[model samples]
Target: MYYQCFFFLQIDRQFLRISTVPLLSTFFAELDRYSPRLMEIFSRKGRQAGKEITQIMDAISKDDTIHTRRACVIKSLCTYLNEDPEKLVKAYLDSDFELQSTMEQTVMGVYVILIEGALPDDDPADIAVLIEGVEVLSDLNSIAQACALLFGLIYCLNLSYPQQLKCT
Candidate 1:
């Protein structure tokens, strides 16, 4: 019985390897055909557009009002995901007292929290991205970078977005 099981497993592995080659080749062929058009649509002056976008994002990230709005948005997203909004992220004033008090309330899951000062002119002190209560990234320079990283992670991990998000 053990030998038969081992033989079937080997045959399955070989079959998978043989079948995957054609699929991979076809996928790459399609990619090659479309890559130039994609580059044309997404690139400008050979990456100058990307730099300009990054600059704009950095400026937006520095705005205190935007940070406040983003915190609210995060809470809303948590609610949409059927998660506890309070557990998603907790914004705190960039003060030692507040930080010490709030540190104890951290929860598990993927989330981001912004620490900023009270003044409108003050930039965020920190932006942290956590997974399962462990910090994966912190003090990201711009919202764009953080977003790109999260998107890349989702793609690499083969995660599916929520149905509502996917429909949009």
Candidate 2:
């Protein structure tokens, strides 16, 4: 799934502006904009959710380089969610199912962040609904999902790339 996203991004570099940037940069950028909104929703849940939000916010806001910040946040979130970062990262890198559960959570977490940021004026409670809204997208496979996600992200952020979409 990760590689599907990677290759999809690679193929749509003009649309995604991801050709020369690390994936983490895009994640961090989106998180920077949307984590606060997530925190707002989670905080209403109770003390535990508030604490979880704090941990995620801390990881996102840490004053470090992009790569380090991503690692920290991924590590912190995985740990808080009761998964081993070492194992998950390894499995994620290896494209294996060992980290499938954790990876799914992480992907959902990211999508939530993206959705929240995308619809800033909407209620955060609608995240699940928003996700469901995209369920009818064609080609329900990893590459297709990645392509749809990238396009959704571009639409959400109103991003403009220097290059034009072109076939190789």
Give one digit per residue, the lDDT tens place, for model 2 in 37-151: 6445544544654465456446335443443344344444444454544332321222334433544343211222122233322222211101212321222222213333444
Q: Candidate 1 — which residues are off by over 4 angstroms?
A: 1-74, 80-82, 96-117, 142-148, 154-168
Candidate 2, residue 92: Cα displacement in angstroms equals: 14
lDDT for 4 in candidate 2 is: 22
lDDT of 2: 0.37
TM-score of 1: 0.36
Residue 25, candidate 1: C-alpha displacement in angstroms: 27
In model 2, state the lDDT of residue 115. 29
| Cα RMSD, model 1 | 14.8
Best by TM-score: 1
Q: Which ten contiguous residues of candidate 1 have the minimum total lDDT?
A: 1-10
